[model samples]
Target: MHIAYFPELALLFADIRFPQDQSPNNASIHLTWRPPHGEAKELDVPLLPDTTSLERIEVTMHSSPTSAYKMGETHNKWLSTCLGYDTVLAYLGENERPVLMSTHQKSNQPQIQQGGGWLSSITSKLPTSLGTIISGDTEPDDKITFADCAPFLVVNEASLHDVSRRLPESEEMDISKFRPNIIVSGAESCWEEDYWSELQTSSGVKLHLVQNCVRCVSLNIDYATGKPGEGESGKVLKKLQSDRRVDKGSKYSPVFGRYAFLGKGDEGKSLAVGDEVTITKRNAERTTFDWPGISSTPLPTAS
Candidate 1:
């Protein structure tokens, strides 16, 4: 198999897709690339020059979203050397395999609260609330790309502002770094999401809050330079540990936003900007973590 190095495929491929309604002759792209082979280093060619004359890639993607990528032995070897990393590339001419849906479950443990923000109930117990966690895991029925867990990630606009105000603001600190699929803004929206396990949009779209998105080192990457080691991400995380560590069951892991999935029978509808969105609290509980504002008094921290 053979493939090209496209770092944008992870996030940008959705926009470059060939239209399904009509012939995409004008939408075609003239791609030029430098192959890792002989005298012909760079080549320019028209992608999908025409419907009949176009070179189509077919792949049965069971794991990845697209199968139009391939990797050859020589290309693979060259890529590893040039990039200083080991990688194998392959292109699927057509989708022969399909992605399937998998299930996940939140720990059915006693809930406890850590800090200010949402009403997160936490406890030092194993999960006792075992519910089906339908995630974006690889499977055999649905089509999914290289996404990590779920289809959509939900973020609270108010929460982003809250994190910014609490932490040292840096030029690198932009909401795009979090990359949320849906951004919700309202009074106490972030805290309400912790309880918005299931809710509906004005367009009759339904969403389910599944898991609290755990923070990672990747958050530290400086978006401007595309490099890590910015102390901003670290400082925000420390503040979360100090302020946002609200989940008692999972106190160690700092989370900002929530992960969500689409509701059954609500697929295919478009959720646009400025849509009136409302969330209902199906499961209401209070946080037990000792912090200011919750009790209107400061609690002692363990050394």
Candidate 2:
């Protein structure tokens, strides 16, 4: 609920901080913007979930003023891991307020209906909290496939905890090990593995729960704090693989994550905190998990 709209959304500045170099004046990550829809217009936003600069984007939708700033997956990850945040979904009523539902807080909160094009409206029912309007098509309800096309509903922090419980203390959370765009709050909750399967927010945003996000060694690096990981991110990831959700060994399952194609209408809606998001069930199964490999895919491939 609370569908607030803005025209010409834009990102003014971006920066990232890491524990490796926690200096207050350290030059955090930054990005260069060309204009409203410059040559970079065709370029995809960096989908990487961890990098600070990659986490933020400047969005301007349909001449709305007060340009909306979209936070990439990293911001979501921090919220769950560092903060205890959860949400539900619903559509905006005539008054532009979210309706309520009796659903438990799931891993992928405020699931946005995903698919096609960048300047579109995502009307999902979300637990009253935060929301953002994004560009892209919400994958059709019947067309399910695992590709980068699905919107990400990641659980970075829970994944870390899942890993920590299994692995020895020596292996802790390192950003390089599990780089996720969104991290949910709370412990003992298999946010990524179980909850994501069928969860949504109040804003009528649809989230296609694809699969458990797999991890790469990049999480081993301490990006925020800026120090060679003492091997924390890896430890949590390994533990999850061994004990938590996504048990590949039992059935030879390839590790995969979920994706939701954004929905239609309200192209380029502005999402902000304290909005309603909604998630609905789709009869479609996701496509195969085919995200470009970590090493092979770079920021240049976001579009």
What's the TM for model 2?
A: 0.39
- Model 2 alpha-carbon drift over 4 Å, by segment: 1-134, 138-153, 156-160, 164-188, 191-199, 224-228, 231-234, 244-257, 274-279, 282-303
What does the lDDT read for residue 292 in candidate 2? 30
Best by TM-score: 1
Error of 1 at 234 (Å): 4.5
What lDDT does each candidate get?
Answer: 0.46, 0.33
Q: Please give the RMSD to the true structure for each candidate, in Å.
A: 12.9, 17.5
Considering every candidate listed, which one attains the maximal lDDT?
1
Predicted structure 2: lDDT = 0.33
